[model samples]
Target: MNDAPLLEVRHLTRHFDDVAAVEDVSFQIKPGEIWGFIGPNGAGKTTTMRICATLDLPTKGDVLVNGISVLANPDNARGKIGFMPDALGTYADTTIEEYLDFFARACGLRGDMLAKRIQSVAEFTELGHLMGRMMDSLSKGMSQRLCLAKTLLHDPQLLILDEPASGLDPRARVDFRELIRALANQGKAVLISSHILSELSETCDGVIVIEKGRLVREGKVESLASNVSKNELLNLRCLAKTSDVEIALAEHPGVLKVRESEGSFVIEFDGDEKDIADLLKTLVNKNLSPVEFHWHRIDLEELFLSFTEGTLS
Candidate 1:
């Protein structure tokens, strides 16, 4: 989509009395990108999100939404962002349609425009069926969908979601992940914070890790995984005996260990791509007749644990 970043945070810092809530944190989110903001409780994830949403001003830094500075032009920056907080304070008596209509009107939409925007977000979020339902009576998943619909009413270019998947069930989490991917595909930049590292690893293009109100690491999920991973899991399926393959792999230069499970050989390899290629060549020379060989790389959880001490606050 666009070459320029849709959201940019430059050395953002926030302090309350003597406590530094956030310190010199900086990151950028380009259009059609989903960046995961990850950390434990009280790690300043919410504070950073508030700054980007223009709800709270940074003490020392600046945030730009579509090149509009949050410090210099907060109203303009707010217009470019749709912020969904951890707790969506909804009126219990309001129906889904009315809720969306109210937000659309508040965003300066009216008449045909309000109606069209409500209908569009309703259809997109699949909230049309629940239009007549009261907010208090809806399920957790349905309420989250409604909140997302409210966030989309103004058609903002950037979405800052704080713990969006927090109380969602397994099925609801999957559906929400798909919905987020769809939004990014439509050229919207999404910066989402969540404690679910495994899910974020699957959906986000990259992640930023913060601890003790300071940035610790920020990069693509895959690249970080590769860099921090010390070993690789490779599964091999061969026509020969499993024990024979295991012994052969154990003696290889790059292989750390080998085990047999079911009808395949599981190998722990400590090597790079070229090493893997050489391994395959060695296997071919040994006439192992491998039917399947696949490498299972490290995941986000491992990468995150490598950097953090695994403690909240």
Candidate 2:
């Protein structure tokens, strides 16, 4: 993978009149990587994206695409990036082919070259079959696919997608994930903002979380997960009665709580990993015969809760 970022946001800030919509946000996205941009409602994700896309200018900061300043050269920036807004308007009378052709021409493509580009994008998005279908009659999934196809018409190096999978069903969501992976495989840098944490965790290489117009965290998902506090987590299954494990752990010095299920025991400790390890070793020495013992890795939901100050829902 390329080490240099294809896109960079440096202390980007945007204000509307007297209100700040984005504040000192910064992140970088390298080629062939999918970066997830997530935040609570009204967290300024769209505002920041708009600035990066050159649709709006930042009040205090700047954006760079392929090492060129977007503020200095917006037309050049537009050529290198594609911005897919959350809500797109579809022309009811236009067919899919016509719609893509129109956008291609608007982007300054023409003649045989424009037709070829349109056809290629349609085939790539699996919309070749739907080329003759009316844009207004397509399903949500089909429409989203068409929108993505349109975005690819110019073969932009960086794609900024705002909730591209918003109204998709489970199957459609999975297909969209596959499409993102395909784009990254083709060396395109993608910045996607979505509320689907699990889906984003599964597909994106890194995540940037924003809150109230400021950046909160930006890193690989695994690294961000590792930063979360994982205190009081225990996973233990016993060879003996589960009650035995629960009781033993509950009576331990640093143990805060012990819960027993059908065949397992969860012991919440009030100490560090070293303490937990010592406790486990003590249990083994005492012959309580625990079958499973491991620290519980926090899931994406828990990580999100721990990191964000506001509600993500």
Q: Pick the candidate with the highest TM-score.
A: 2
lDDT string, candidate 1, 42-102, tens digits = 9999999998998888889999899999999998888889999998795978888788888
Alpha-carbon lDDT, every model: 0.88, 0.85
Cα error, candidate 2, residue 98 (Å): 0.9
Per-residue lDDT tens digits for candidate 2, residues 34-88, read 9999888888999988889999888898999999899999999899998899987
**Residue pairs with backbone overlap in model 1:** none
Taking all chains together, the TM-score of candidate 2 against the true structure is: 0.84
Clashes of each: 0, 0
TM-score, cand. 1 vs. native:
0.81
Write down the RMSD of all candidates, one decimal each: 5.2, 4.4
Candidate 2: deviation at residue 254, Å?
Answer: 3.8
